[model samples]
Target: MKHYTSLLFISSLLFCWMFISCKSTQRLTDWSLVWEENFNQKKGFNEQVWSKIPRGGADWDNYMTDFDSCYAMRKGKLVLRGIVNHTQLNDTAPYLTGGVYSKGKKVFSDGRIEIRVKLDPAKGAWPAIWMLAENADWPVGGEIDIMERLNHDSIVYQTVHSYYTYTLGLREYPKSGSKGMIDPDCYNVFAVEMYPDSLSFYINNIHTFTYPRIQTIEKGQYPFNQPFYLLIDMQLGGSWVGTVDPKELPVEMKVDWVRFYQQKSIK
Candidate 1:
């Protein structure tokens, strides 16, 4: 009987050790820093780390523009500003400036992504910090929006798009009253925690939404497991942002930083 009791005790101790170790390993908050860009001193986008969206109207979804350098650095911040100019395509009015991107450079997968950004409060500014799969297709591999703003309100959106479906999750804080605004500059830290089984969105340190992994990714399609490049742009007057107010021209989206973290491996 003593021999059996000793064996049981040893088994229980082993199980307890394993449980504690797993609990520690599963803690997402204890992530290790894998990559980050503070954007503190650089005057322009790093060519080695980022590629510019070439000057052209074909790349833009539907917005019209006569591309002339739309991005600049001012007072230690990366600023995307819109410019309006006349174009031969439309003689009735002047062409408005816009931006769209992600061609080459840094890309990755299966990690936490964060961006610190302040957006323009103008009526037609649509600014976004997002990611697209390395695969040469649209929504086939996947798309993850770390932060997106529509000038209609102070609210911001974080979303994930797959070939199967698109999900837009929202979190808003008013500038005053019971729902006080999270920040004064209309800016906040936005982050997305991407895991094998789920995705979580965080705004200004507050957890807002969690999406469970979809099983059977449909037609054997699971593209999110691959690396994706980041895209940051300030589009003017799109379906989401609507028509621009001429008085609101030359609006800017300020980016403080972009960071990435990865959970440590259990093994």
Candidate 2:
């Protein structure tokens, strides 16, 4: 009888220790919210944090515009629209899109960035949430594409670009990125957790893939450890996404919120 009682007490103690260990592990991995934008203001996007992405010669932003009709704030959401250019007869582009960047206003590093958004499908709609280095130029600096949806795709692309991947064409060597399934009709959460050694991508809280820094003589194998600014845009008629159908013009992408988080255990 004494032997039986001793065994029960030992088992109970072991169970308690295991429970505490599990909780501690979870706590260490948990995140503490650092900054967030809910777009709850009655006016447009907070100018203190965002600015209209300038029109560039690239196919992606050639039609980028500062038109009032392409941007709106409704019911705590930032709405970016891509519309046919009937009203803007003076503007040569056939379409105008709305986009904003935190280039000079806000920047972050070594943390997780998440965006909750819903996209409306158009024949040539391309909406993206991405990050770019604050000071460095293209390919060499690095590009982190948290989420990019082309047309009516049910899956979004999460990718990273660097000199190694683009210039040297070493895309598959270190696994540059991945694509994850998403719901076309409803809002989905897309996130990228940036660490000094790796960038982890997730969709709807499901782990999609991780791109790690490996030992290499390549000059720009991992340039993502530096500060980066965020960009969210509603783009249309890109060569990769094909031609726009005027019948489906005026499509929009609704952004519910954006958040940045750091590990709770970190300072």
Candidate 3:
């Protein structure tokens, strides 16, 4: 009887230890909220966190930049309106759309980024919340797309494009793309938790995908260690989105909030 009781006590102690161990691991990541934006301002978009300029680097897009009426803040929500206008951007695009990037304003190396948003349910309304390297050039600098829904897609794509993944095609084995089902009319939390070696994507707090570091691959393939800035936009009539419906003009991409957190355990 004593042997049996000792065994039971030992087992109970072991189980308790394991439980505490798991909880400690979760507690290790003491995340500190670094920056956040709720878009609750009554008048205009915050210029300190975002820039109104539409970068000319998207050579594949067939649209121009417009700052006058393309974006607005209504009822504490930031709206990125995509419209068909006669606005000419170097005679290349006649449609006026809105995009905001945090190039020189704010950037982070390793942290957690979350954006709560809802896309307008209109065809050719391509909305995305993503990040790109601030220092390096296109593809080579690394692009981490937390959520990109195009052409009224019911699914959101989470992808990473880097020189190692795209230019050299080193990411051919594990397949560096993932998607999650989402509703266009409702607000969903799209997030990316960037670690030292990997990027984990989440939608509405559910884990959707993970882009792990290729330790065996070349170092050039991993460009996520550097500081990356955020970009939120509603791109209209791009090559990927096809033609727009004039009747669906003035599609609004509403953003409720955005947050950034830097982990203290990442030393």
Candidate 4:
């Protein structure tokens, strides 16, 4: 019975991979790849394109650690590790995790962004591929979440936050029908196409959510005009994601690639 169950699980994963891989190419054929991080090297990433957080930066109840060991590269992909009480580092957090950002080098304007990732659904895992404004203050600068999942659940959350969404109490949750369900155990594509007028989110190239420009609200939600940088993180546990189970130690978020593209202009 166990062997048969294993085969079934493998078949499901293969099906998911086939569906996701084909959809990514179909959706992005119109745009040309401008910048991409394939995570090719085994040791250290391209310092010019990506940067890591050496120490966990946390002022709230969430755990953040600066230990570099929480990250690694395997099979030509970047792996973000989350572990319990990473005692090897001087970080004071109860848990140690990994985070990386494309802040200075890879900030981009309105375009297409795609990330291929595989997540472990162990309890207490909060993995996300998101973006933040290059300038402005918190809650006012704007945040675009391409994908975020909590506690190994199947739902993928895509949200936009700004002064308007904050005052409206819609930061933590979406404005309804703005989420999709996905299989985290297999590689899936999460994408966002940011236009001057609106933003669209997708899972495996399937349109799942959309956020339009709220013009009537003034600067309440208009902070998304400038460039934004990408951030990929594997958070251990927090207020919204709850607590991490110590037994589910050494969980990881595997990222195959992050590619950015721009639509070619016609002559």
What lDDT does each candidate get? 0.64, 0.92, 0.80, 0.79
Question: Scored by Cα lDDT, where does model 3 land?
Answer: 0.80
Worst 10 residues of 2 by lDDT: 20-29
Report the C-alpha lDDT of model 3 over 141-246, residue by residue, as the tens digit: 8999998887768898999998778888876644577989886678888989898888888877667878887656465667788899998888776667677787
Winner on TM-score between 3 and 4 is 4
RMSD after Cα superposition, model 1: 13.9
Residues 1-267 of candidate 2 have per-residue lDDT tens digits of 999999999999899768855763464368888999999999888999999998999877999999989999999999999999998988999999999999989998989898999999999999999999999999999999999999899999999999999998889868998999998999998999999999999887778999999998877999999999999999998778999998998999999999999987745
Give the top-scoring candidate (TM-score): 2
Residue-wise C-alpha lDDT for candidate 1, range 1-267, written one tens digit per residue:
999999999999899868755763565457887887765554666667766554444323344333444676666667776655544454333434444354566786788887877877777767777778777576667677777777656677776666555322111211000111335276677777777666677776566676555455353134467778887777666666677786767777787778888877777
- All candidates: TM-score: 0.72, 0.89, 0.82, 0.85
lDDT (Cα, tens digit) per residue for candidate 4, span 125-227? 8888888887877678888889888886888888888887876664433352277989756888899988987888888888887777654644566577789
List candidate 1 segments past 4 Å from native: 1-29, 55-69, 86-102, 166-184, 220-222
Off by over 4 Å in 2: 1-29
- For model 2, the local distance difference test gives 0.92
TM-score between candidate 4 and the true structure: 0.85
Q: Could you tell me which residue pairs clash in candidate 3?
A: none
Better of 1 and 2 by lDDT: 2
Q: What is every candidate's alpha-carbon RMSD to the true fold?
A: 13.9, 9.2, 9.7, 4.1
